[model samples]
Target: MAIIKLSVTERRRLSAFFTCLVLAFAAWIITVLSNPKPYVVKEVLEFRNTPQKRAFRPLQSDTVNVTINGTGWDMLFSKMNSAYKAITIDLHTLESKSYVVLSSQKDQINSKRESDQQIIAFNPDTLYFDFSNRKEKRVPVHLISAVRYQRQFFQSGPVTLNPAYVIINGPASVIDKITSWNTDTLKLDSIDESVVTRINMQPVKEGNLSLYPKNIQASIPVDEFTEKVLEIPVRVLNGRNIGEVKIFPQKVKVTFTTSLSRYAEVDEDFFEATADLDLWKKNGYKTLPVVFSKIPDYCHIIKIEPRNIDFIVKE
Candidate 1:
């Protein structure tokens, strides 16, 4: 409940004291961080100069704990840099040796990094790999896409990929299970026209597997759609007595939507409607349901008039 106010001179002295204390703290930090120190950071491992005669699969994880000797500034910035995430290891020695000593290649690895930072050591000081029979094969390329079309717009035809197949080289056991290689997802919104672009293929997850031509060209056909109506004759399927089975409405109207470019090319011949007579013989159904046995590609059926037809089976 007591108010004590200091004199202006006393307040100035207090402010100066605090300011000096802050400067001393900053000076200590600068002195300590300026000196070189060893710090540990985990980095991904990538292999280069892979042996051609043999296929390899690492027995351990693809990451290593690397001890880097550098100033505090270098260590701080290296962690923040995305490029520092992975360190490439030379596999040239694998051609003759089964393992690689990380320390022996420290100089080679440090050459690619900043001059201020040096790789001193790494955990799992030695890397071991398992060898397998090398094999090469050609597999089809599968495109992955997520596209949304505008109103009355659709894909008119199948998407075409340049170099429809890619060559893969890897361990025999791994390549045998892979039938196709998939491209990275091609995402688009409100697609109204054909798409022609180059997309990169998905990176091989296994370190040993390799793909030629990391990217490919893709072409997609898109067109506006319009409604078309056709009178399709219904054929009786699985009829024990074909001539004896009589169905009302032999022909039904088929309404469907097709691309504008192919509107005139489509007709009743492109569609096959059928009424199964087995419903009355086996299931004792009163009416037969009209089913479409075939339809043109990319054609979407909207409605079929008289879905179920009245039938009379003569004994």
Candidate 2:
């Protein structure tokens, strides 16, 4: 069959319809681009400074999961960004019955120029906090853990610590968690009788925790306790001609104290005493000064301690 040609009026009507459709499409595109729909982004948010008691250990983690809203495209492109750092969370603001709701800030938004308040939604409006109030107590800091000792020494016994107890104040919820205080090892070894010394105290791991005194005091006992009287003989070193020399009452006295076990080890044989004889040779003097030779390490001069003695040399 032969096709029938369209009338001018019919053609005009079809053209008008096509033009209207194009215009509507263009308007729709502009509107969609100008006013984009919002998007939601999930991020880990942090809250800090939740009031911990001074005697309590500071909690290491304070982060919560949260969803943020922003530009649809921005959220689609990058939903998760940097790990959220905690904005300060004041624990003091919270009461036993309720929690404080922090208002979202402008900078809290996940996307640029988008308000976090507008796009963010929290699963729970406020996090529930549980606390048990505790009465104040003075608990002693015990050095229960044995510290590592230095090589060549053994700890004689349990070390005595000064001001062992600490006054702690916290809520009943937290005070129950505490146990006792500990310390680093005190080294005792190869120690002589004079080995009386103290060690420093160890620091607690928790920052919020408090002790009576910031420092720990410790004392280590040594095993050096013996007493002995040693008879020491004195001699003159490097002497020459002697016309005439005489020492009145010669020998000096010395004493030492150590443990009974090691008493035999302490004796006059441990030290040397001597006097200079060069003056006799140089002066060719008939009379010279008497001098003592060596002194023992394990002993000290007693009542008859002589600093100077007379000596005679043959000329």
Cα lDDT, all candidates: 0.90, 0.50
Error of 2 at 132 (Å): 4.5
After superposition on all CA atoms, what RMSD does each candidate show versus the true structure? 2.2, 21.8
Give Cα distance to truth, residue 230, candidate 1, Å: 0.8
Name model 2 segments beyond 4 Å from true: 1-62, 66-87, 95-97, 104-125, 144-146, 173-215, 219-315
Highest-lDDT candidate: 1
The number of the candidate with the highest TM-score is 1
Model 1: CA > 4 A from native: 1-5, 77-84, 241-243
Error of 1 at 102 (Å): 2.1
